[model samples]
Target: MKWLWMTGLVCALFASVQAQPQPLPAEVQKRIDAIFDGVVDRWIVQMDRWWHDGQHEHLINMTYFAIMLDPHNISLYENAGWLLWSSDRDDEAVALYQRGLRNNPDVYDMYYELGQYYYIRKRDYAKAREYLEQAIKFPCEWFVWNTLGHVYARLGEREKAVETWQELLRRFPMMPVDQMEAVRKNIRDTMTRDTTPTAGENTQQ
Candidate 1:
C-alpha cells in the first residue's frame, strides 16, 4: 500500500531534476548526497512521519541524488516527478512523465499519470487522449477507460464517450454489476442528452 506511494514519490524526484541543470560541483554534490543519504537512511525509521515533519525537508532535497544517478531510470524519474508535483511543480511533473516516456514507455503507471497531467493539469484533451491511449494499451488495473470516457465527454464527443464505455463493457465483462449498469445508463443518458442539442440550437443564431 504505502510501498507504491513511497516508490512513486521517489520516481517523481528524478523527473524534477530535468527542469534544472545537471550534476552539481564536486563539493556541492557530496553535501547534497550526504543530506539525502541521511534521509534515505531513515526511511525505515520514519515511515509514519507527517507531511510537516522535519524529515521530509531532506527527503525532498535528496531527490536530486536520484536524478543524478541515471537519466534513463524510470522509477527515479517517476519518484522525482511525484515529489515535485507534491510541491506544486506541475509543469515539472509533466516534464518528468514525458522524459520517462521517452526512454521506456512501460515505466510503472506512467501512462495513467501522464493522462491525468494532460487532462486535469494541462487541460489539453488531445494530449490527454494521447497519454490515455498509451495507458489503455498497457495491462494496468487503473481508471484508464473511465477517465478516457470522461475525456471524450469533455471534448464534446459524447457519442465517443458512450461508445467507449460500451466497448469497455464488451471487453471487460467482469466489471462490477453496479458499475456495469451505470455504464449502460451513462451511454443511454449521453445519447439522450446529445439528441436534444440540435444543430440549430448549437448555432450562433
Candidate 2:
C-alpha cells in the first residue's frame, strides 16, 4: 500500500516499454519518465504527511490525480475511498470501494474497511456483519472478531454473540483480564435479560 504510487508509475512505464510495433523516441520517453518521476516524488511527500497527519482531503485529491495517471492501480481506489469515507462522504466512498472491488475482487481490506464504515459510522449492523464475514474469509483480525461479536449482540443474537466472544477468549487466552471480564459480563447480562428493556431502563437497573 505504501508503494501504491510507485506501482502505478512502474506499470505505466512497463506498458510503455511493451508498446507494439514501435516504441517512443528516446528523448520523448526520457522526458515522459522525468515528468512521471516528478509527479511520483510529489505524491510521496504528500502521502508521508497523510500517514502522519490525517489529511484525508489532500490524500483523496492526490489519489484522484494518481488514478488519472494510472487507472489500473487498485490501491489508489482503496485509499481514496478510505479518505472520502473518513471525511463523511459516504456515497462517493461506497462507489469508489465498489469500483475497487470490481477491478480486484480479492482486495479483502476493502471489505473490512467498508464493514467498519457501516458498523461504526453508519450503524448499519446487518451490512457490517455481512462484510465482516466476507473479510474474515481472507484474514481474521482480532478487532474484526470483537466488532463482529458486538454486531451480533446489537442484532439480538445473544447466543451467537456469546459464542463469538468465547471463541475469541479461547483463541487468545493471554488477552487482558479486564477485557475478558467485560466479555463475560456482556454474556451474563445478555443471558439474564428476560425483557428487552430500553437503554434508560437498563441504566436505572
Candidate 3:
C-alpha cells in the first residue's frame, strides 16, 4: 500500500512536470501546485506525529519522502537538518543543508541555517561568517543581522559587530519595541566595551 501510494505521487509529479509539452496557463499551473502543496502538508502532519512519538527512523524516512515530493519546502530541509544534527549525525546534517542550497540557491534561510550549524555545532566562526554574509545578500529576517553581529563579536571584530547592529536598527525602524530596545542595548554595550580602556592599557598610560 505504501509503495502504491508513493508510486502514485511520483507519477502525479512526473506528469505535472514532464507531461506539460505545451505551456500551462499561469492560473492552471498555480492551482496544480496548490493541490500538490495540500497533499504534501497532510504528509508533513503525519511526520509531526511520528516525531512526537519518538519514531526517529520513521520520521527520517518520511522527511526524505516529503522532500522528494516538494524539494522547494525550506522548512522541511531546516527541520530535517536540525534533527540529524541533534541526533549526532553531523555529516548528514551538513549534507542535507548543502542539498537544500543546491535546490534553493537564492534562499537566505538555507545560508542562515548553514551559518547556525557552524556557529553552534562546530564553533567555526569563519565558516559561519561566510554563510551569514551570503544570507544577508538576499532578503532575510532581522535575526540574520543579529546573528552576524554576534559572530563578528565572537571573532573579536568589535567595530564590525557594532556596525552590524547599527545597520539593523537603521534598516528596521518599525521592529517591535522590545526587540528594538534589545538591539539598542547591544550597540551601547558593544560601544562601551570598545571605548573603555583595558587594564593593560590603563597601566601603560
Backbone clash count for every predicted candidate, in the order shown: 14, 0, 0
Model 1 lDDT per residue over 35-120, tens place: 54654545534432522474544544444344444445455555556667777888877777776676566643678778877776
lDDT of each: 0.64, 0.70, 0.81
Report the lDDT tens digits of candidate 3 across residue range 1-205. Answer: 7834864776577566757789888998788778777777888887788779888767776776677668889988898898899999999999999989998999798999999999878878899999999999999988899888878877778899889999998888888888888888777777777453232321100
Ranking by TM-score: 3, 2, 1
Candidate 2 regions exceeding 4 Å error are: 1-45, 50-55, 65-79, 102-104, 176-178, 194-205
Worst 10 residues of 2 by lDDT: 196-205
Query: Which sections of candidate 1 miss by over 4 Å?
Result: 1-59, 63-83, 195-205
Looking at candidate 3, the ten consecutive residues that score lowest on lDDT are 196-205
Arrange candidates, best lDDT first.
3, 2, 1
lDDT, model 2 = 0.70
Q: Any runs in candidate 3 off by more than 4 Å, and if so which?
A: 1-35, 194-205
